[model samples]
Target: MKILKLEIKQKPFDDILSGKKYFERREIKPSNVIDYVSFIVDGKEYEKEEDVPEGDSEVMVKAKSYDRLKLVTGEYKGKRPYLMVEVKDAHVEFLYDENGDFIVGVEKGKEYAIAHIVFELGNVVEIFKGEK
Candidate 1:
């Protein structure tokens, strides 16, 4: 079968890395999984907590903290698929602020919201606005 690949942009710490450039593409499989080659399974210290939004029971993750994300085998549309990822453990830790709620990590009074998304291939897609 033909492989479908999805292209997503990634931004890393500029100072820590050599240079910022376009990230690689993950090979998509019939199962809807996209296997990424950039990430590695380095068992690191990760954290996990319940991310309960107001009046919500879907406990999505909040943050990955300082852990290396893992890439696990998952199913996509009933087929074994892969995904390009950042955090790939069975569960991830969410970064919290003093209030105990999931922090957006943006400066106060900002007009943006932080969102954490988990894709089918065990990737934590984090969208942050502004600086912490």
Candidate 2:
């Protein structure tokens, strides 16, 4: 499995840490083979890999999940994933963005099928406080 090193903003980072945000949305999807995504604060970097934590401190999830979301408009349809993911073990159905032009969210009461890949994350994993 490939590892993706991402730099995220402070607010999103805080949301992840606080459990307010479960998924990280992106315009471009990462490779399906990625099983671990290591995140660093927008301007921070880690020098040693060994310093990263393991086990319960991290949240394990599927790497990639695909779905087709029915748009609010009955005449149109949108692709799912909008890069949605569940944080830790929490269960979240779908994500919606009012500004999005495509599929914004799932249809009122319909069930949508989703696909998933294997991945893991945590509060602190080999975090190095420095510019990337």
Candidate 3:
């Protein structure tokens, strides 16, 4: 089977990050905005390679001109806050094996900042950028 991919357009972090601040007011919708995962700590660079926590919180994912997708939040025993992205498919193969257990591997791919969302630009090949 062929793999589905997405692409994130190049834009400044301010433009992308601004979309999240108003997701609940129905000001955002899914269209073609870039998706990324990121966190702010002590005014320093916090990479997604770190672990996240488990919780019933919402993670806002905004596209440049699309509706923002609210995602489920999770946590880990280690440092850093973790956010989960909503995937359209249930591809079990995309998951990761953490010490003999299966876990949603959102950060398994490349690392890029799309619309303030932290993700690898390479993993998102066709979905956002479209197929060739």
Candidate 4:
């Protein structure tokens, strides 16, 4: 399955392990934001090969987003905690400014720093005891 590996911290990790946290948040950065699995804009083809089309619009990321999410935490009690969760669905939200509007920056009419991808976590399929 397609897995998205993420490094998590202690506090949140404990919450997730205890089933207190239900969702995981990750910002859409260049290193992670690549070609879309399948997304359209304004009822038109948004070009899957391209990152995003020019205009003020939003699209839902699907399929290739990831079938599973791998969360890893650094050394804790001489062991790194690692958890693999099934990603049921993912939601994408465009960032806004102080005025609470979508921030579509300049660089070829793209928004690199203005989007958030939240993973709706499902069951914890696997848990691995990481090395110290």
Candidate 5:
């Protein structure tokens, strides 16, 4: 399995940890070869997505919830992945704001346009809190 590291803020992080948010929507899609990915939250390793296991109820839930989707974005880098996801199923389509522009990030009342990326997270695979 190929592991990718993502830097996320507190709100989205909390949403993911609480199971309130499942998909990590981004303007850029990962390489089609990636099979599994991981995120570090408070020093804990959370497995966002993994290969579809035949008889695993947990994995089944994820597989059933998400369909193979993709969208195009700005320039991006491609690397080898463990599993190959189709380009069409890996891209992220963005919704335009009222100004007919994509909002990348927001602070105060100002919005910014920038590239973004998403990742579908799974269960916690490892924990590294309070370790040296």
Candidate 6:
């Protein structure tokens, strides 16, 4: 199973840990065009729309199958606090401008959205406080 590690802030982390947040969303950066907005799994990059595997999820961007999401409190270290949780689903959404219209463009190649990434939250596998 592919495990995606992400450094998250405190409030959101707490919400996820407490079962308040059901999914996590990441805004696509301007620096990364649609083609570049992707996830690297096992040395392979899932960048294209057809590349990410979808399991019957109705999302603008098909959800990639990630087994676990390793969330870190801050910079990842040898013994830092981390939360490993089962990833129920993952997907990407398009970007909308101030007018609410869909914002699409070509950068290096054809692409979609500003890149809204959605990773559905699942059961918590492990939570390490990082205290030694």
TM of each candidate vs. truth: 0.20, 0.28, 0.17, 0.68, 0.33, 0.64
Clashing pairs counted in every model: 11, 6, 28, 0, 14, 3
TM-score of 1: 0.20
Judged by lDDT against the true structure, how good is candidate 3?
Answer: 0.27
Q: In model 1, where do residues sit more than 4 Å from their true spots?
A: 1-90, 105-132
Higher TM-score: candidate 3 or 4?
A: 4
Q: lDDT at 25 for candidate 3? A: 16
Model 1: lDDT of residue 120: 25
lDDT of 6 by residue, 29-104 (tens): 5443342245444445666545656565433334456789888885555677889999887777777889998887
By the lDDT metric, which is better: model 2 or model 5?
Answer: 5
lDDT on C-alpha atoms for all candidate structures:
0.29, 0.34, 0.27, 0.71, 0.39, 0.71
Could you tell me how far off, in angstroms, the CA of residue 112 lies in candidate 6 after the best superposition? 7.2
What TM-score does prediction 3 earn?
A: 0.17
lDDT for residue 14 in candidate 1, whole number 0-100: 21
Q: What shift in Å separates residue 104 of candidate 2 from its native position after superposition?
A: 14
Least well predicted 10-residue stretch by lDDT in candidate 2: 67-76
lDDT of 5 by residue, 1-132 (tens): 333444445566555546686666654323321232333333444444343333424321111123322222222345211221222122334556789886565545645443334455555334322211
Query: Candidate 4: misplaced stretches above 4 Å?
Result: 35-64, 75-79, 98-100, 104-113
Put the candidates in lDDT order, highest first. Answer: 4, 6, 5, 2, 1, 3
Question: Which candidate wins on TM-score?
Answer: 4
Better of 1 and 5 by TM-score: 5
Worst lDDT 10-window in candidate 1: 32-41
Residue 19 deviation, candidate 1, in Å? 19
Better of 1 and 4 by lDDT: 4
